[model samples]
Target: MTQPGIDAADAASPRRIRIRTCVATRERHSDEKLLRVVVDPEDFTGRRLLADPKRRLPGRGAWITPQLSALETAEKRRAFPRALRLSTAVDTGHVRTYLAELADGPDIVRKTEH
Candidate 1:
């Protein structure tokens, strides 16, 4: 039975969780701080792929920009596991591989040709 005045359609919609990830950039002022990424995906493909920023990975998610410097900073600061709230250490190689795939994306390669 539906509640009085409450729309059934609205109740059926899945609830969304938003997670924010901060990534550092190469630029001194603009990229030095943190890059905030919002995770709103219902699946892990997006977060796992790193190619699409729409879908987020399952469990706790961490955000870091597609820059070597930023990745280094995160590693040095132990930001990945911290963001994920996991006491166990996360593999840096995994993050590197993910970013490598993103860097090899069509857009990035195209921009490099110029």
Candidate 2:
């Protein structure tokens, strides 16, 4: 059960939902409906992007709706670099692969729903 005031909504709110805005669509969505993209942890150049479904990666992150169209729009409009405050060219290859897997792999287990 939630404390009296925390996440208060008649005490029936199981948890406070995190809302994030999509850089691509300029729309607000709950974290559950968004995909977070961050600079790859292993890349110091800060140019390569990684799609973080788990939302656990460290660094500046940009949220986008988890859809192919949204991804394409963000990439086409070059929103990541601006949102991430990066001056270098941003690459989305890794994130593309992750989204592809999500589209094709029904067996894939998503872990951050809660």
Candidate 3:
């Protein structure tokens, strides 16, 4: 069932993991460590922010560290619009709420190796 020179593990492993830079901290991290945000087009005010944890949203998106401090720093520096390349203002309230919920959720207990 195996090819002459093919390794099954190599075929199963991801070819490449995406790396994203946080707009707030200007630090590089894997896509899993950051959250993607996009402008809420449905909002008539065009200033609302939407958290795209799944990273499936269309159009331009900005990456930020999944921490309250990082979100605050991005807001303070007004980095969303610039990162998203949108001229309209962006409201990060939704993102803040999402992060808060994540923080308050039950902690995952990791199994320790003896």
Q: Which candidate is the best by lDDT?
A: 2
- Native-to-model Cα distance after best TM-score fit, residue 34 in candidate 2, in Å: 0.3
Candidate 3 pairs with clashing backbones: none
Best-to-worst order by lDDT is 2, 3, 1
- If scored against the real structure, what TM-score would every candidate get? 0.46, 0.79, 0.79
lDDT of 2 by residue, 6-49 (tens): 77576764568999999999999999999999998898787999
RMSD of 3: 6.3
Per-model CA lDDT versus the true structure: 0.51, 0.89, 0.88
> Candidate 1 lDDT, tens digit per residue, 6-111?
7899668846654444534323332223333322245343332122244334444456666666778977886765565656655565456656766677553334
lDDT of 3 at 87: 86
Segments of candidate 2 deviating more than 4 angstroms: 1-14, 107-114
Residue range 1-114, candidate 3, lDDT tens digits: 556677887766737888999999999999988999988878877788899999997768899999899999998998998998878777888999999988789777999999
Error of 2 at 64 (Å): 0.7
